[model samples]
Target: MVSARSVAVRARSGNVTRRLLTGLAAAALASATALTPSTAHATPPAHSAAVPAHALTGYWQNFNNGATVQKLKDVDDAYDIIAVAFADATGQPGAVTFSLDPAVGYASADDFKADIKAKQAAGKSVVVSVGGEKGTVSVNDEASAKNFADSINKLMDEYGFNGVDIDLENGLNSTYMAQALKAVHAAHSDVVVTMAPQTVDMQSPQNEYFKTALAIKDFLTVVNMQYYNSGSMNGCDGKVYAQGSVDFLTGLACIQLEGGLDPSQVGIGVPASSRAAGGGYVAPSVVNAALDCLTQGSNCGSFKPSKTYPGLRGAMTWSTNWDASNGNEFAGQVGSHVHALP
Candidate 1:
C-alpha cells in the first residue's frame, strides 16, 4: 500500500531528462477483442459561444525509449510545449510506440524521476500520460492501478513530474478508474491529470463513455478533445480530429462545458501526418495535395509532408516514423509554434 502520498525515488537506467509520456500512446497497442460498460453519469456537454480557448498543448508520440531519441530531441528542438508518450510496461497491438524487446525492461521510477528532473532543468514541463485506446486493462479486474500508482510515485519522488495524464481510452468504466487517478494525485499534489477520449460527435454522443469520464472530474486535469482524423471510421476512429476541423473541435468544447469540466483543461488533439490506406494516420497532406493537382494519381505514399496548424498549445504528429523519411528536419516547424505561445 503506497498510501497515495508522494514517494521519492532514485534514478535508474534508460531515463530521459524531463519528458513525460502522456497521451493515448500505449492504449493504441492494447488488443481490443472486447468492451464492457461502467456505472457513472456525465452532464450533457455544452460549449460557449463567447470565448474559444486560445492555446492548447501540442503532443508528440515518441516511443521505444531512446529509439527515437534523436526524433524526440528534434521535436524538443522544434516544439516548445512538447509532450511525448510512453507505455507503462505495455507492448501489444496498435501501440503508438513501444519497445519490442521484452527483456529490455523499463528504467526504474527513480530513473524516470531523473529524466523529469533533466527535462525541468531544461525548462520544459513533462507529464506522464498513462494508457491509450487499449484501455482494456480497466476492462478486467486486472486493473494495474496499484502498480501504476506505485511506479508513478517512485518516479515522481525522483523526477518531480509536473503531472500525470490519465489516458484510459475505451477502458472498462469501473470504480478502478477513480481509484487510480485519485491515488496518483493523493501521492502527488501538483501532478496534473489529462485525458483524450473518443470523439464526441453526432455518432459518439450516444455511448456511455462521457459518463465514465465525468466520474473523476475532480482529479482530471485536461480533457484533451481530439479533432484530427476524427471523421474517419477506423479503429478508435483516428480521424476523430483533423486540422482545420473546427466543427468537431467546437462539439468537444460543448461536451466539456456540459460535463462541468473547466474548458481550460480541454486541449484539442491533431495529427501532423496525414496517413493513408484508410488508417487515419499522418501522411504529407501537402504532398498528397500536390500529387492530386500536379499529376492524377492516388495520393498514397507519393509524398511526405508535415502539418502546420496555427495558434494552439502546438501541433501533434501521429508518430515519429512512417516512411523513414522524416530526417529530423521538420520538428522546428512544429516547435516554433509551441515556442511562440506563452
Candidate 2:
C-alpha cells in the first residue's frame, strides 16, 4: 500500500526480535497513555442513513498495479464500499482534479456513470480518495478549505461518488479539514465520509488526525486505520504491538475504540496479500481472528477488550487490484466473515 514511498526494513510477525527502547521514546508513550481519552460510555455519532452495515471496503486504483485494469464497474461483488484511489490536487491550493488513467483505455462518461448507478442500486458505496503516499494536497487557509469542498462536490456531481475520503498521508489541518467536510456534507446531506490514516496517525487521542476524526464524527461513516506498514506501536493497554500479530491488530484498534469512536465507525485495514505491502501482509485467517477478537471476545491475544463490539464495522484492504491478483481470497474469505458478524 506504500507505493512510491520510502520503505523501512521491518520484522515480520514470525521473526520479530525485540529491540531496546530509548528512555525518551518510553517516556513519550507513557505521557500519551495518560492523556488518551476514554470512550467506554461514549455514544455513536449520528451519521447519514446511507451508511452500510459491516462493509467490505476496498480501494480501486484508477491505474493498474500489476493486475488487470478494472473500471468502477469491474469491481467484484464481495466489496460493498469502493473508494476510487485518488483525486489529484491542482497547482492551485485545495483545488482537486481526477481523470481515469489513459493506460487503461477510457470509456464514455455515460458508461461510467451508468456503472456507478448500478453499483449504488445493488447497495455499494463509491467515493474518491483525496491523497496517496505521494500526495501533495494541503488546505492551509479558509479559501483553500472552501476550494477543497467545492472541487470535491464537482467531482461528486460528475462521477456520482457518494462522498470523499481523507487519505492525505503527508499532513492534515484538523480545523480546515473539518470545515471542508462540513461544507461538503451541507451540500450533499448524505455524503459518506471515510478516513484511512496510518498506524502512528491515530495512536493517541490528541493527535491532529484524531482531532479531525472527532471534529467530523457526527458525519463520519468509518475510519479504516491501515494496520500494516508500521513497525511497532503502543496499544491502549500500554503494550507495544508488532505488525502481523493478532495483538497488533486488536491492540491498536482498542485505541480508537476507547478513544471516543463508535464500534460501528471503526474498521481494521490490512494488505490483501504479501505483495500488496512491503512488510505487513497477514493471511486472511489472521484478519478474521482479529475481527472475532474485537467483536466476539474470542480468538483474542494479550489485550482483549473489556466488552465486545458486535456492531463494529468490517474490514478494508489497500486495493482491489491486489485482491484480484490473489484470486480474490481477501474478499471471499473476509467478506463472508464480515457479513456473518452480529
Candidate 3:
C-alpha cells in the first residue's frame, strides 16, 4: 500500500546494549496510603509553544485505569501526552479513568476524545501507551493484535487522538517484539509509535542486546531509560539518586553516537524522587530527590533536564502520579524541557 505517512521499520531487536537509556524518573502514584497534597508553585502564566513533531513532550501514566474521570481532567491540563499501560497477566490498569472493556472489545472514545480536546486546549500531543515492565506482550498476537489495532484506530478516529506509545515491556525484549511493532505500525501509519527500552549499559556489557528494541518502527523517538540504579544506595533517607548518573549519562551519550539515533530522539530519565542508602525499590522519596535537584539545571542525566538531549529530543517521566499529587512537579520539569530545547 502506498502511504505517505507510514515509515517502514526495518531493524531487528538485537542484544547490542551500547546506548544510553531514557525514561521518566517520577514516582508511581498508585500507592496505598493517601497521597500528600502538592505544595503550590506559581504558574508562569499559560503560554503555548509550537511543539515540533519530533519534540520531546510526554505524559507519564498521568491517568491509569480506575482514575476518577475528574482526576484525569485535573492533570490533563498539564501534560501533552497520556500513557495507558497493559499487561496480559496483570489485573486491569487501575490508575486511569478510561480503559478497554474486554466485554465491549473497544476503548472508551468519550474519554479519549475528551483527552484530545484537553491536549488541544492545552496545545500538546495526546497519545496512548501500551505495555510496561509488567506489560502484556501476548495481547499483540495476530488475532488479538488485530482487534487491538482496530479498536485503537476506531477510538482515535472517534476521538481525534494524535498518536500511540508502545511500551511493551518483557517478552518484547526480543526481535519478535520488533516484528509485532511493525504490525502495529501497519495498523496506524500516521500515529507516533514510541518504544521505551531499558538503557544500554556499555560499562556492564551484560545488556548489549537491548541497545536496540529489535530495530523496528519508523520513528524510534523518546527512550525512557530508568537507570538500574537499585540497591541500598536506593534507600529513602533523603538523598539524591546520585550513584548512577555518570553511568546513565555515559550510556545515553553512547546511544546517539554509536546506536545511530538522533540526539533529539532520546529522552533522558532520572529519578525525580530520592531514596536512602538501602531503599530496595524506587519510591516517592527517590522522586523527591530528583525534583530537589531541578534548580541546578535541566541538562544533566538527573531527573531534571537542563535541556532536552542537547543532541536528542527531550526528557520524560516514568509515571504520572508518584512524586506529585497532580502533576505540578513533573509538568514544570516538562515545561522547562520544552522551553530549553534548541
Candidate 4:
C-alpha cells in the first residue's frame, strides 16, 4: 500500500532510519518460533470505552519529519486521540519497541511518560502507531502473532499508552493480526484500537485491511483511511473519483459506511497541510464539508450518500506536528467541526 508520493517524499528527504522487514523474512522468522497460549487467545466480542462519541485523531511524529517538533504536552487540545508516530521493529519477528527521538527534545523517558500521564489525565488517549510509509513489520504466523501481542502489551505497560494503531503500509495478514489484537485486548480490556489503512485497502471488504477491520469491529475504535497519496479510486457508487475533492472524501467514505462498518468506526484521514503529504491535500473547509455531507447530507459534492449517518465517528490528520507548522488550522477548523457533528 505504499504510494508513489510517499516513496518520493521519503527518498527526497533521505530520512531512512525507519526499519524495513520484508514479507519473506517475517514469514520465515514467524514459522520458526513456537506458538504460545497467550498468542492463541481467542478474540472476545468488540467493545471499546475510551474513544469519544465524535473524536479528532492526530499522529504525533516521534522522529523529526520537517514538521514542528512537538512534545506530547504540546499536542492540540482538540485532539482526543494522539497516536505516537511509530513503534520500531526489533530483531525478533513481530516484536516492536519505542524510544523517544532525541530530536523531539524529551529530556528523559520519565519526562515523556509524565507527558503521557498528563494527557491521559486530561482524558486524551495516547497510542503507539506501528508502521508508517516505511513500516513493514509482518505478523503472518502464530508465533509472530504472539510476539506482536506480547511486545505491544509490554509497550502499553511501560509507556502507559492507551492503545495501538495498525498502519502497516506494505501488507497485512488479517487472521494473525486479528489474533494479535485480541490477545492484546485480553491483556488490557479497556485498550483503544485504531487503524490507518490506505485508500485502496478499504475500497472493498474483501481487501485484507478491510477484513481485519471487520474481524475486530466490535472493539475497534475507528478506521481512519488515508485519503491522500491515492490516485483516483471507485466510490461506493462504483464511480471513479479523484483525490483532493469533497466528492473523493464523501464518495469513498460511503463504501465503508454502506459496507457493514458502523458509522462510528469510519473516519476521514487527511494531511494537515500540503507539505504533510505528496498529494490529496484538501482544505480544512473540504474536510468539514465532507463531515457535514456524511453526517447531515449537506455540504455534499456531486456524490451524495443515499442516507446521512449522524453517528459518523470523525476525522484524523497525518501529524499534529504538521498542523502546528501550519498554524494549527486543521485542528482549529476541522477539529471544531468534528466535535460539533450531530
Q: Choose the strongest candidate by lDDT.
A: 4
Kindly list the per-residue Cα lDDT of model 2 for residues 1-342, writing each as its tens digit.
233211311111000000112343333223221122111112222222355678888988777556556777777888878888788879889878887777555667677778778888887888888887877789877888878887887888777888888888778898888877766665554678889988888988798788888887766888988888878889988999898999999999999999988887899999877777776788999999999999999999888988888878889987787788888899999999988888
How do the predictions measure up, each by TM-score?
A: 0.53, 0.86, 0.56, 0.89
| Candidates' C-alpha lDDT | 0.37, 0.76, 0.38, 0.82
Q: Give candidate 3 misplaced runs (Cα > 4 Å).
A: 1-70, 76-78, 86-112, 139-155, 173-175, 200-214, 228-247, 275-309
Give the per-residue lDDT of model 4 (tens digit) for 1-342. Answer: 237223333642110010122334333234332433243222222222357789999999887867888999999999998999779888888888898889999989999999988888887888999988677588998888988999987888788888799988888999899888867766555568889999999999999999998887756889999999988999999899999999999999999998878899889999898888889999999999999999999999999999999988899998899899999999999999999987
Q: Better model by TM-score, 3 or 4?
A: 4
Compute the lDDT of residue 199 as modeled in candidate 4.
95
Better of 2 and 3 by TM-score: 2
The number of residue pairs in model 1 that clash at the backbone is 50
In candidate 4, clashing pairs total 3
For every model shown, the clashing-pair count is 50, 0, 56, 3
List candidate 4 segments past 4 Å from native.
1-49
TM-score of 1: 0.53
Q: Give the TM-score of candidate 4.
A: 0.89
The TM-score of predicted model 2 comes to: 0.86
Model 1 agreement with the true structure over 1-342: per-residue lDDT tens digits: 001000110011110111122423223112111221121112211111111122224344443322233233333434323344544444432222222232223345444445545645555555655555433333223345554555555544434545555445444444555555545545443345555554532123334445544655544545554444344322222333333433334333444444444434444454443331122233333322322221232232322123221222223333333212344323444334333433
Candidate 4 clashing pairs, residues 3+ apart or interchain: 46-218, 46-219, 47-219
